[model samples]
Target: MRCEICGKKLVEEPLKIKVDGSIMFTCKECSKFGKIQREAPKPQRPGVSRSSRVTKRIQRPREPTEEVIENYRDIVRQAREKKEWSREELAEKIYEKASVIGRIESGKMVPDLKLAKKIEKLLNVVLIEKTDNDIRDEMGQSKLKGSTIGDIARIKRN
Candidate 1:
């Protein structure tokens, strides 16, 4: 280990010191500038290796996410019309402004999951769908690996 303050190589055990509210591993000579602190021993889990923990995380499956449907505008508009509710009435029911409802109906805005859920419960319509996390290429092949920084750099160069 090296000294934090003096930047000199430490032959002996480094001292833990608290300087200006920050703890640092410093050499014995520079330790006089700060209050000496006892080093706390790290707790180890029984029979749990770091490699095993990493492998377990890598083997875990990705969870599906909720996404708004493509024709949400038409579905919401039709549901509202069937209930004989105006844009202002629907907006008031959802605690949102009439402009928000108008924008959603006109395809100028897409409702988030929270808003979609509220509208679905109030209008009794499906506006959100669960989608898998798998990404596909143009040829419909699953892309398990993500693009690295080197790949992005090559693309930019091209």
Candidate 2:
């Protein structure tokens, strides 16, 4: 075993201890980090075999849900003015910088999904529209089969 804090290989038995509420085994030298735990909670077992432990989970690729509207700047500016709020007031409401709000309203910077949603809620606007129903399938060729990350990273010395 190795020390969790220092990563040094321990020649002796690792000290069984707890950090916070979590139980951990650390080397003797690194045991001073947390208070020694008297008894760690054990998992309930009913004598199941190791072969039953292996299980697989299926994961589907995530579909894009939202897209920013074309005239986002005009929409945001109009909505903020409708509420009679200054750039600083709007930024404080949304937890963002006043300069960022100005840039967003002036069409200099496009807001990401999270910020856009917050703005939409505060200003009562539809800055983004859901696009999960209409999937775009314009992807071209797939990658080659056999190449690995290590293969590309190896230096070619002549």
Candidate 3:
């Protein structure tokens, strides 16, 4: 038998797994990538085809919620420093990669809702918030003249 993913010849029975909901016979190495999905009994009708019996799946659109607060990097960096925590320490405490913490602190990456929440709790700071305009924008009903989120942010010259 051959592996479905790597196409390697196998001496043992092919591993059965469900990759993105499709059950496939895979090799030992390839099988680690997906969940185990039991094979459904095929219908024995003479004129029925398996492809025709399958239904198309439609997924509902998701709404965008919890945008990063203005000046998130500065806030996070300040909070982390106030507690005398290094970047590695914060990453270790949060169970995330040090690169992720570095990116967030340098404003190179925005923290997702879950990561933001973790950061908020750890640093005692607010990293994300939901606004009426955010909801309206997600629903395709935004009426703001500004094209970007930073349009409303105030810039001060020292």
Candidate 4:
């Protein structure tokens, strides 16, 4: 499909989704201006109803369960530990408050899309695995240069 904002091409990948049913359809480069207004459903009326009766169906946005959010936090924390990086080190690398990292790892709070992407890039792991529900960062895709704790250790020696 084409980008809703730039009209550019869109690959078969996920996009960042907001709680209000707003989906970002373009690449991250074009996401800066991909603000599409959410269209509300029109009210419906039953033909059999003689009286003036309008039925409106209100759809609530999807919300991640507490358990699922906690799972994501654990995944991030485990990835960081696998890298043998302390909370302070990760915080410094991601340019976030150590307390924020601590809270996220402990499942005290959920990271916004931007913060989640930052952690994923710095940790070099798919902390937030893609599901039917996830904000895709096409431009922020990163690969571990050489994974494994040994490789990381060797890099520090140089």
Q: Which candidate ranks first by lDDT, i.e. highest?
A: 1
| Tens digit per residue, CA lDDT, model 1, 62-148 | 654678877788778887887899999999999999999999999999999999999988986667665653433424323311322
Pick the winner on lDDT between candidates 2 and 4: 2
Tell me model 3's lDDT, rounded to 2 decimals.
0.72
Best-to-worst TM-score order: 1, 2, 3, 4
Q: Which RMSD values do the candidates have, in order? A: 14.2, 17.8, 14.4, 21.1
Model 2, stretches more than 4 Å misplaced? 1-62, 135-158
Candidate 1 Cα deviation (angstroms), residue 8: 30
Candidate 4 lDDT, 28-59, residue by residue in tens: 56655545323443335455232223331113
lDDT of each: 0.75, 0.66, 0.72, 0.58
Better of 1 and 3 by TM-score: 1
Name the regions of candidate 1 deviating beyond 4 angstroms: 1-61, 133-158
Model 1 CA lDDT for position 66: 72
lDDT of 3 at 40: 62
Q: What is the lDDT of candidate 4?
A: 0.58
Per-candidate clash tally:
0, 0, 0, 1
Clashing pairs in 2: none
Task: Write down the TM-score for model 4.
Answer: 0.40
For model 3, what is the alpha-carbon lDDT of residue 116?
89
Weakest 10 consecutive residues, lDDT, candidate 2?
140-149
